[model samples]
Target: MATPKSAVYAASKHAVLGFSNALRMELAPIGIHLTTVNLGPVNTNFFDNADPSGKYRQSVRRYMLDPHKVAQKNCKKPL
Candidate 1:
């Protein structure tokens, strides 16, 4: 759960998780693969686009993940 200020982000992520779970179950019988990769904060231009003011980005800079590292890890062991 996110703080009140980030309720929208939390809700949207939860919705994606729920939908992915349902889709995975539905496709299992059909031998279809459904990989849902839930990535953490990646260091990218997303902050510039999402929060141009940089207020939120600066506040969470320490928590941001490295996009290249994340991609490497995902490639090695995807979910």
Candidate 2:
């Protein structure tokens, strides 16, 4: 599932995850809480905007997450 086109995006997310973990540790001493929701690709217009050919959308349609469900569950409970 790795590709040259996604390397930058993946790397940036990795950086953010690492940064958030470090921040969480630092903030723990002050009783500040942090949460990270790592939801995979959600059903959105992202495909329509990014993939005009619809090939990518078709390929991942089965695995795509539902944005509403994701938001609802996250709002109802913390990780």
Q: Whole-model Cα lDDT per candidate?
A: 0.81, 0.80
Tell me the spans in candidate 2 whose CA falls farther than 4 Å from its real position: 1-4, 74-79
The residue pairs in collision within model 1 are none
Which candidate number maximizes TM-score? 2
Candidate 2 lDDT by residue in tens digits, 1-79: 3444478778878888899999999999999988887777788997787778888778888989988788778685754
Q: What are the TM-scores, per candidate, against the unseen true structure?
A: 0.61, 0.67
* Per-candidate clashes, comma-separated: 0, 0
* Pairs with backbone N, CA or C atoms under 3 Å apart (clashes), candidate 2: none
Summing lDDT over every window of 10 consecutive residues in candidate 1, give the lowest-scoring window: 1-10
